[model samples]
Target: MELTLAQEKALNALVYFAERIKPLYLTKAIKLLYMADEQAIRDTGVPITWLDYKAWRFGPVPEDVYNKVKQVDNLQKLDAGDGVLYSLKVSDAPADLPEGLVLNPIRPFNDDEFSDYEIEILQKVIDRYGKLTSEQLVDILHQEGTLWHRVVQANNLKQQFELKSNRSDYIIEFTDLLDTDYKKAAFEVAYQSHLMQQNLM
Candidate 1:
């Protein structure tokens, strides 16, 4: 499948993190991206990467990007058209390699694809969370009042009532990360406007 602009940004973000941490862990990369998106929404009412996240067992997972990484891991390279190449190189097979996916970028990330604000936000997220392990990040996302935790809890409640429920199948709304009703309403306006612009495009 062809990569969208946001997906390209996601890869670039991963590459940026990989450059700093050597072979970045795949789970950590995804978690960092999610955190960046959530922060972007809180700060600007827009997400840097408009990736859809699922309420997965570990945390909020950008399932599309995660699957793309797995595909690239097996194929060694993914061409996003226009001769742009995104590839992953496997590092050592540690005990947690199966779950960790220690990977390095084959090429340098293109910062030209991002705006100044986007780059700043990404770096901010890295500064805050880059050093954390995948498990630690998962713990943070699964904290009592986190959006991921809320989705998981709601799904459990639904199941307890014998209602239709799928824990990992639920989409975690990024706006839910906003703590207040005022923020949520403000985000709804911004999100609807974004949708309109996308339609015009």
Candidate 2:
């Protein structure tokens, strides 16, 4: 399948982080992107990217994004100095080679591509988690009662054999991350926006 909207947003989020958090390790980068989506899902009652997260040892990883980045690793290693993808010299990904996509200095993304809500979410997550290392972030994700925790602890057959989790499935109005107050506000905002759009239609 072609890149989904969330996938494109995931890439855009990466570009945003790379611009600010220069010399970002792919490991930290991926985790940051995941957190951005999680934070937005919590705040807005919707996810920035509807990624199918696999509960990897570090945290929840987008399996497709991981594979794609891994496939690009060889090219980054060989052509890091000159490759367009690694024009900034995506350094060695800290996580096992190929998985941590070390991003080089790349151009900042165009602002036009992101929604106002997306921009706000990305900035908020970065501001909150910017200084955190991958290990620290992993610990946060590993906390009890987290989506990562429940899915991993359960260890269903799908998880045991194929590492699948429907927990990460995307559905509006279904995020467990958001607090009740936040959910209420989000629901109100969404309802208002829906009504406005309907009026226009």
Candidate 3:
């Protein structure tokens, strides 16, 4: 599938984290991206990458981004102009990635694909979560008040959560990240505008 502009940005974000974190594992990179998007939604009523996160067993997983990261073997074929240009070399791992999949960036991260606020948010995510291991990040997401935990609880699947199962996944709403009713309503407006803009392209 062709990468949407948002997906391009998300891929670049993967690259960004891979550059800063040595031996960056796939799951950890995804979690860091989710954190950045979550923080951005909290602060600005909008997500930095505009990726649609879902309540997964490990935490919030952006399925498209997850799939894209998995396609590291084929990333060199994608040539979306004006997007972050790079390729990923996947380190050897078992099929299930029990030890987590490592990603090595083969090109420089392109900051031109993002806004100033987005850059700040990414840096903040790195600063806050960059040091944590994949399992540690998952622990944070499993906390009681986190969005992932709330979704799992609301669906009565906290104890029986399954990974990559259609029956267990729930789409994470961006508005749910906002604290105030006013912010949620404003987010709806902004989201609608974003959709319209995407449709025009």
Candidate 4:
């Protein structure tokens, strides 16, 4: 597919960053792509997605386009989770990691404010669904035009389970760490920071 000017710019930026800072987390790489796309949209008023760039703009890229981009750029993939239960190699690393695996520090969002209505919505989802996937939560919030807010809330939901599947059956259970108010707060802060940084960029 033809590359939009915005898509080209975002891909180029992603490649540039990938080369400079080999990330350990695919989500971080995806986040970088999203950030670049967000920035491109902010600058040029064009919207793009990883799927769009991979299938349309970049032209016949690999199924794992983000990972392929990292490989082509000579960046190493490291242990990371896909925010779901399964373990997957991530392409970005936190700044504090060992040498030769340096990654750009993720910027924290300045705004930590959440409206009462937002919190209420989150409580409602937790009350209704108990534990839910991020994608599922996103679908629910999309209807209300508050997908972003729910993304923040899902991140804030303290209880996390590592999903396991066997024979095409799936089970959701708690992770090793017990849920606590502190963890929930940290998740909220991180989620908000991620959202704000992406939106800002």
Candidate number of the best TM-score: 3
Off by more than 4 A, model 3: 75-85, 93-98, 162-167
2 against 3, candidate with superior lDDT: 3
lDDT per residue, candidate 3, 105-189, as tens digits?
Answer: 8888888868898988888888988998899999998898888888888887755665435435588777766888777877888
Give the poorly placed runs of model 1, Cα more than 4 Å off: 73-87, 90-92, 95-99, 157-167, 178-201
lDDT of 3: 0.79
TM-score of each: 0.79, 0.67, 0.85, 0.27
Candidate closest to the true structure, highest lDDT: 3
Regions of candidate 2 where Cα sits further than 4 Å from its true position? 73-89, 93-100, 156-174, 178-201
For every candidate in turn, the CA RMSD to the true structure comes to 4.1, 6.8, 3.2, 17.4
Better of 1 and 4 by lDDT: 1
Summarize candidate 2's per-residue lDDT along 112-201 as a digit string, tens digits.
657898888888888998888878888998888878777666754235435643344322223556668867677567656645744663
Per-residue alpha-carbon lDDT of candidate 4 for residues 111-144, written as tens digits (9 for 90 to 100): 1233344233323433453343323433443342
Model 2 shows how many backbone clashes?
2
Pairs of residues clashing in candidate 2: 88-104, 88-105
Supply the TM-score for candidate 1.
0.79
Q: Is candidate 1 or candidate 2 better by lDDT?
A: 1
lDDT of 1 by residue, 24-69 (tens): 7888888998998888888866787778899877788888878877
